[model samples]
Target chain A: MAEKIKPPRIRVSRRIKKNKVFKVKVKFDHPSFTGLAMADDTTEPVFNRAKPVTFIRNMLVYYGDELVSRLSLSSGIADDPLFTFKLKATKEAPVKIVFIDNFGKRWEASKEIKFKG
Target chain B: MVGGLTIPLLSVIPSSNDAHGAVFQTPKDLENLTELERIHLPKISLPPVVEDGASASIVCSVDHPMDEDHYIKSIQIMNFADPIVIKGKFFLTPVNGEAYLSTQIRLSGGEGTVWVIAECNKHGKWAASKKVTVAAGGC
Candidate 1:
């Protein structure tokens, strides 16, 4: 029997205040595909490099329908990719974040925050 | 007789000797005026001076109140002392008489800090309110 595969996950957080700066962090978990190569009777490695495993993570901030900020994470292991960013929000808006891995896989998540008076 | 003698005494005042010396030949021409009256001439109102490493703010007000949809199209903050860019943004909104714009800035690659400058656009002109500086903590 073949083992099941799991998709990546994303997390987001922000302060609940109006017109205040807040920080956001994103993370991704790498999927294990080593067993699949063994079952196929192939010694070829799945990853191009000899590294154990790796994952790619990205962070973005959106205001009202516009992409206000973006940051890219490169050459990091799959343990967990974390990033921190600052933004000032004047109104209550939803922040969307997207994360993608090297295997052409993608995951997305979002968080909505309200500014306090 | 005192008034007649006063005129002769006033005539002894020295005047500028120029080609058109007759233009200012009387004692009245050499009379020293009050300092305030002499200095009160046409002048341009200059903005307040903000020192380096110091903070300042700018404010923009409109004749009429605007709704939440109103936003700042663009903004640019420049350091008058040098050719450094303090902050640049495309969208911002004002609330409670202020719009908070913060920048994660570093001076000559020293330590990273946050420089907060307030700004607003009224009618068609832009103005700044004040500046607030926040030192960098950790990553």
Candidate 2:
């Protein structure tokens, strides 16, 4: 349970394409929370991470209103992760990429993709 | 017994940063690594000399098919000088038709080697590294 949601830096290599399988890289910054242990009656640490952990949970990508892909992530992912892939599109639309942290906080960013059909 | 000893050996890992060590970010972890001969390491693009503290985009690319059954699982960037070696990691699926990822990373002063490793979902792991010289002062 996160009380606050932090915005992340997102970048899309290009905003326009030729309606074919176009390659674009999606980059975002995320922190992984690591809980610390304390001795005493308390079993849980005061705050989960002595330092912010770079673990992220899931990434939901949307092409306009339609979902394009969903990626499940783990602490195995490094901090400030970058994902690159080719997009197959037929027309112009807005590409929305949402990063969901392990705490369930959601931050979203978007890019306008113009595919020359 | 081999079975009983193996369990303890696996748990007796070094007191390292297991919290965020992703995978092959250190030499100890690379001991018995799979030498993915067929998988080619990505082509890394960066300036010959990066100013210290200045943000520089480290682009890595590879020519691989991004099919549903066969695809690049993830990519990792590591630097030995960095306190935390893992600079970054990129995860991908078949939806993304190619294997490429670029991101900005700040380097400390002096010379260091940047290693790039990619893992294909079906295949093992492939790696490549580049020697970078960070200028004395960050611009």
The TM-score values for the models, in the order shown, are 0.34, 0.56
Per-residue CA lDDT of model 2 for A1-117, tens digit only, reads 244435544444444555456754566655442222222325432223344454567777777787656655555344455555456664577778888887677888887876543
Tens-digit per-residue lDDT, B4-37, candidate 2:
1110111111223222334443323433423443
Which parts of model 1 have CA positions greater than 4 angstroms off? A1-15, A31-48, A51-53, B1-139
Best by TM-score: 2
Q: What's the lDDT for all of these models?
A: 0.32, 0.56
* Best by the lDDT measure: 2
User: Which residue runs of candidate 2 sit more than 4 Å off their true CA positions?
Assistant: A1-19, A23-86, A90-94, A100-105, A112-114, B1-39, B136-139
lDDT of 2 at A104: 70
Error of 1 at A111 (Å): 0.7
